[model samples]
Target: MPFIRSAGLRGLRATITSLDGDADHYARLGGLDPAALDADDILMPDLAAATTLELAAADLDCPDLGLRVAGHQDLSLLGPLALAIQNAPTVAEALECTSRYLFLHAPAMRLTLEPDPDGVDGVAALRYDVTAPGVAPPPQGTDLCLGSLHRAIRSLIGEDYEPLGVDLPHPPLAPPATYEAFFGAPVRFDRPSALLRFPSRLNDVALTGSDERVRQLALQHLADLSPAEAALVAPTVRSAVDQLLGTGAPEIGAVARMLSLHPRTLQRRLADEGTSFALILDEVRSSVARRYLETTDLPLSQVAGLIGLSEQSALTRASRRWWGQTPLAVRRVAQSQRTVA
Candidate 1:
């Protein structure tokens, strides 16, 4: 139930349409509503979005659908995060911004710049990983992510810049040469994670477009949208809530036990961060309810059960509390929005 911002699928519709495949059709098949997705950024189940890319590749008879989709995107796809990255004074700062804020884009994923596994001097590795348990990022989705990362770096530095190599956890979906051509570097598969290797010196190179004022504004926007501590206690507890919500309302004690913490210790840590277990649980439930309502055609009773509500009436009351409307009303509004879009 890990969710990602729908911006993660920025180029999907265009890619599918260009291939003469039905984007809306494929989107629905992958448990998404194309109309609901196109109007605004919303939370999408990470696995569902990844599967859409995978299924689209097969349907379009294009083994490189992921790369093609990535080719259509750049840092701008990240909105405020892109603004922060592009306006940073140095490549290192840009990368740091990404590592810090990419959770805003894909909560299930992680990005890091670390020492190269090969121990190559003057080289570094930019790693991308899907951190959610039991959900492996499919080959197409991995390619899309790495491909976009490579494109974004080139846009930041120079078009001539190339990674020394790329590492992917899965086998090549297209010919190895195809990946090499796209990344402008050697491609290695069956690796531990998706990675881009580049000269360590690149980190220090200054970006000509750097604007301190713009970067600060963008950073402020991101901060206003989410807490700086989102990466730590909040995310761990949120993840646990997402996992346990299907069975029943997740109690803080159960979550604390899962984290090997005493309930009071967990509460204390959350309080230190200016939040509480109750708030996180409510947020996760709200998000899950919205996803099920807008993206799927599940019955109200089923949706209620999935969110750990006792019955349809409980779901209606919860929906009213969360959205200022009943469950059916929420679905109607979503449907109407899609129709208008």
Candidate 2:
């Protein structure tokens, strides 16, 4: 039973209209007495208030409603994690640090960073895993998480910075056109994960106002505050696979070596965690394939190479099997709305 800090709760409260209409309902739902919330620091359990509003909004067919809520928040809502990111030397370092310290802000979920699954040239993704326990994840909650993360990165990298695209696990509630306009990027629903893709090189861009001392302090604080060591393996393995994808399709032995564990031991451990190396590899490939097809102009042959195929036809075949459409068709559908603009 983890609690999402007041910052997330307040984001939900901001979505309410007419004080007499939803304010009291929100507070009551949250188990709050209406006057105690500070908007910046009120902690709410997922079941008490957050999920109710999230589901209600989705039921009303307003999927992007969470994006509107995220409009009122920024990196400052992340508190010390924000300081850590702002002080890091490069955007990549900032992202790594943020993922390392996810429990501090959003303990219910974690972030997964990966190179383009096909190890597509210059592409990478930072994905959100919102399947934390205690409460079922809802559309509104997913929206806020994605929207705020987008805003948070833009705040760090500059306003004009945008990921090549965003992916969602659920289908769009509004018409595809309306939702696409709000996200300002190509968005695909019913995908494997919620991901934001960008050029991997962006990781090297130095932060404008970084300070090593501040970064060190933030890291130290996160270390002091992180949960038991047992909670870290899955994301660690995924990250290692991400970096290795660009070299070739990732291998369990290579990933195990990177993690400093014997291959057999690593296999056992991942199995105990309810997954396997091959399954993780498939997931990684799928995530990357979808991303590259929709966002980048890489030739199909190159795309196939990056993902371990010997030919473009192999990629076309795989795409059809995985998505029920050819890679070219996926790309065209993603571009259709923009063609009209």
Q: Go through the candidates in order and give each one's C-alpha lDDT.
A: 0.82, 0.71
Candidate 2, residue 195: the lDDT equals: 76
Task: Please report the candidate that would top TM-score against the real structure.
Answer: 2
lDDT tens digits, residue span 1-341, model 2:
67666676455555665222365565675465554245656666655545555544644445566776778778888788888989999888898888878777666677877765434788898888665521235666777778888888888888547677778766675577765676678888765467787778778888898899988898888778777753657767866775576577788888988888999999888888888888777666666676566656678787777666678898888888878999899879856743652
RMSD (Å) of each candidate, 1 decimal: 13.0, 7.6
Task: Count backbone overlaps in model 2.
Answer: 2
Worst 10 residues of 1 by lDDT: 128-137
The TM-score values for the models, in the order shown, are 0.68, 0.69
lDDT of 1: 0.82
